[model samples]
Target: MLTQEQISAYNEDGYVKIEGLFTPDEVEELGSEMIKIIGDWGEETIGWRGPWREKYLAEDEQQATKAVLMHNPHFYSATWGHVMFNEKLVGCVQDLIGSSVQWHHTVLHAKPPERGTPFPMHQDYPFYPHDGLDFVDCLLHLDDTPLESGSLCVVPGSHKDGGLEHIMGPDTAPHLPTDVYHPDKVESIPIPAKAGDVIFFSYCTIHWSNVNRTDKWRRSVRFGYHDSAMRPVGRYEDKVESIPIPAKAGDVIFFSYCTIHWSNVNRTDKWRRSVRFGYHDSAMRPVGRYEDDPYRIDPNNVLEGNTNTIVSGYKTNSEAN
Candidate 1:
């Protein structure tokens, strides 16, 4: 589905653009179906509405925030659902993250000519906070997006910084402070894309867009897919530092269940055995069961109706829903 080189690029740079991910026919279908699903709305009904509007625009250019947008297009059109379920796209994503990924949400961002909105630097973590860094957003372009036509710009390798602080309060959209991280202020790169191309980017990467100065509409459909087995840091705070503790046999490690942690894949064909169990205080009561619960899945036993001499700790997150 994806080359190892492509996967490596995403791991190192936080983003990768795949050209011709969809065919020309597929792109046309998406654009036409989107029109049908939205129908027609008066100009007054459309515009970007975020508190950062004033900080990024002038009195005259305030209307530039008049970008067109909608959420969950798949809810309205089966065509979108079909595209979301594209086999190559999903398999490529699995190659990067893991075997299991879930749909977080979908969005339609249609930038109108001249008055299209500009998204300031921001990390998507604030919009949909999750437990792991395996969360990825896929953008399907239906128009040729040049730098001036709100092409996405990203800070390379920034996801390694993990989540960053954003201005979040009542009635405000979460975004980085303009004074510190606007396009002109931050180190960035514009990702110009052709119709039918798809851009896969991490949720933690700092991203923003320019206004659509072109005459045509810059349309894109975005689907957010996340690994069910996500592992990341902070309840709501940005990452500070990471420490790796290498161990040998006979080593014991202890950590809070709340900590977002994962073990490297077992590379050997032979069994890599370990005994894992959790202990809690007598006063504590269990309310939720996670994916790796011992009670739900006995590590020592083979799957139901199967015979196995050794227990292989391979996991799969393969679900259409």
Candidate 2:
């Protein structure tokens, strides 16, 4: 439900792709409730508990669930807080962050099979910074991301060069300076997506991903939205070409938060899942790390409420799960 040339191609090529919204039985009941919270044909059927508890292990548990990465599964799945309050993705977040929207928190990048993991190229305001970029990352691709199975890559406008300063290499987290992606300074585009597609972007857009050399297993879920009045322009900077639009599954991508993206590494054997969730703008307020758990997936506070109200001090790796 957006067109003015898709809002002027998300304001001069930032990002935009909306095709199926969510059907196929709501993307097969949100991929069978994320395979019962990432059990993937093994065990761990739901019993959802989070707080990242050492990524939940009870033994080998398939080698501790391939280093599980599941933060805020709607705070322990009420079928993922009912698919993270999807009313056509909050009416496209009130048509791109306008009327009352707050509820920022949701992650479930469950990249399993063939041990998936390879997100570099950084910029989400250095781990969710805020204030001026007005945040908005809604990447839910739940599978069919090809490019040898690791699809998603960009550099189009490069968010007009904003946030580009992430040091310390080899993904111990803080990243960016890989000589600022030297392909003669930058030009990487591999945006393949399917299975319930959704790829909105920003957070000063520079993106990354690689290493799924597919054998089956690729998941996504990044829903994060903002604009209530914006806050947290703290600063710490660093930061697409190529928009291969071929959506299917449940298409919906709307970029802005400083667009520049990345993804590639699923060497295919099949299996790529995803499901992320987030929204905020209900008169803003609660800054940094959502000011102590300010979870609010609207629908009148979906699964519960937490308009915490803490102004600064941050921390969110799903608040350690």
Candidate 3:
């Protein structure tokens, strides 16, 4: 159960880190399980793009390893409605989002050293069709995460606001215009953790991470949950779809669909492994495509034109520019 102080902190800052939430032994077991899964997928490239396309078929073993890491097994018996829905986790989620939360999805992010890339700032719900309101996310750490390694950075209270407009950049969103968002911003707070520690934040919270400059690899497992009332924006893809993975250890970061978040690249010479899960409010309703409504601003992205911005240290990826 969460203490009054913990609850208060969450309410005030929009996020909280619970230390020593999981034992070292548990972290190790989960890591080993991930390694086994990666091995099973064989040598293949991993990421949003296809791993075994014609160009990558002849790459070295390292390239193959990268490919295989992205081929996560969504229905793996290890995660199938079991480990993710355990009583302890569920109970805590119930406390935050109410007893009616439902499972949404899961993702396993594995970043090999010198291979992971930086993830830009963006809201999780923007990609989905759900309405942005009253949702929560739970992130579980499976390894020790430090500043040198990639750790999550969040803008306290950004969630209470709404989404910001993003100008696409050359490498990211080249066609977009500049002078899109207003200036003064909030700073992002870095939340580091050891194995077993969990961090929970709302979907509307704005957050990002830094690159792993250390030689040691960083890894984590994240699970997201939301109110069931949110409608699905598109087809139900695998819970563990490929996005930019994080490079750190014992870092579990979860959020709701409406939450704004991102991660950094792994420049160090190590492997970053993490798993992720998504859930929804049991009472959420389905909404169709969000693009149709021009007057309706996505609460998750309300910071676009505001000059006084919070969490200004981290920038969105080039695509989000």
Best by lDDT: 1
> What would the per-residue lDDT of candidate 1 be over residues 1-321, giving only the tens digit for each residue?
889999999999999999998999988888899878767531322354566777777877865456667887765666776766688788778888998877677888888887688888899988887777889999889999988898999999999998889988766668998788887777999999999999999999999887788898898888889997764445646654667776778888888887877665343344557687666553333343345774574444433322222222342223211
User: How do the predictions measure up, each by TM-score?
Assistant: 0.69, 0.26, 0.58
Tens digit of per-residue lDDT, candidate 3, span 1-321: 777787777777778887876677766776677666667753443332332122212344323323123322344435423546667666666777667887665555554554443233444445333555556667676667776566777778776775444433333421112222111244567898787788887766666554454555566656677777666644566444447644357767676777666665343344566678654442333343346686665544433322222233344334224
Better of 1 and 3 by lDDT: 1
| lDDT of every predicted structure (CA atoms) | 0.78, 0.60, 0.55
TM-score of 3: 0.58
The true-versus-predicted C-alpha distance at residue 233 of model 1, in Å, is 10
Q: What is the per-residue lDDT of model 2 for residues 107-191, given as tens digits with 9 covering 90 to 100?
A: 7775566545445565677776775665667777767778765566767667667777776434246556665463336676767
> RMSDs, each prediction?
15.8, 25.4, 21.7
Model 1 lowest lDDT segment of ten:
312-321
Cα error of candidate 1 at position 77, Å: 1.0
Relative to the unseen true structure, what is the C-alpha lDDT of residue 77 in candidate 2, on a scale of 0 to 100?
51
Off by more than 4 A, model 3: 42-74, 77-81, 166-186, 233-321
Please state the error at residue 302 of candidate 1 in Å.
Answer: 62
**Cα distance off (Å), candidate 2, residue 147:** 32
Candidate 3 residue-wise lDDT at 235: 57
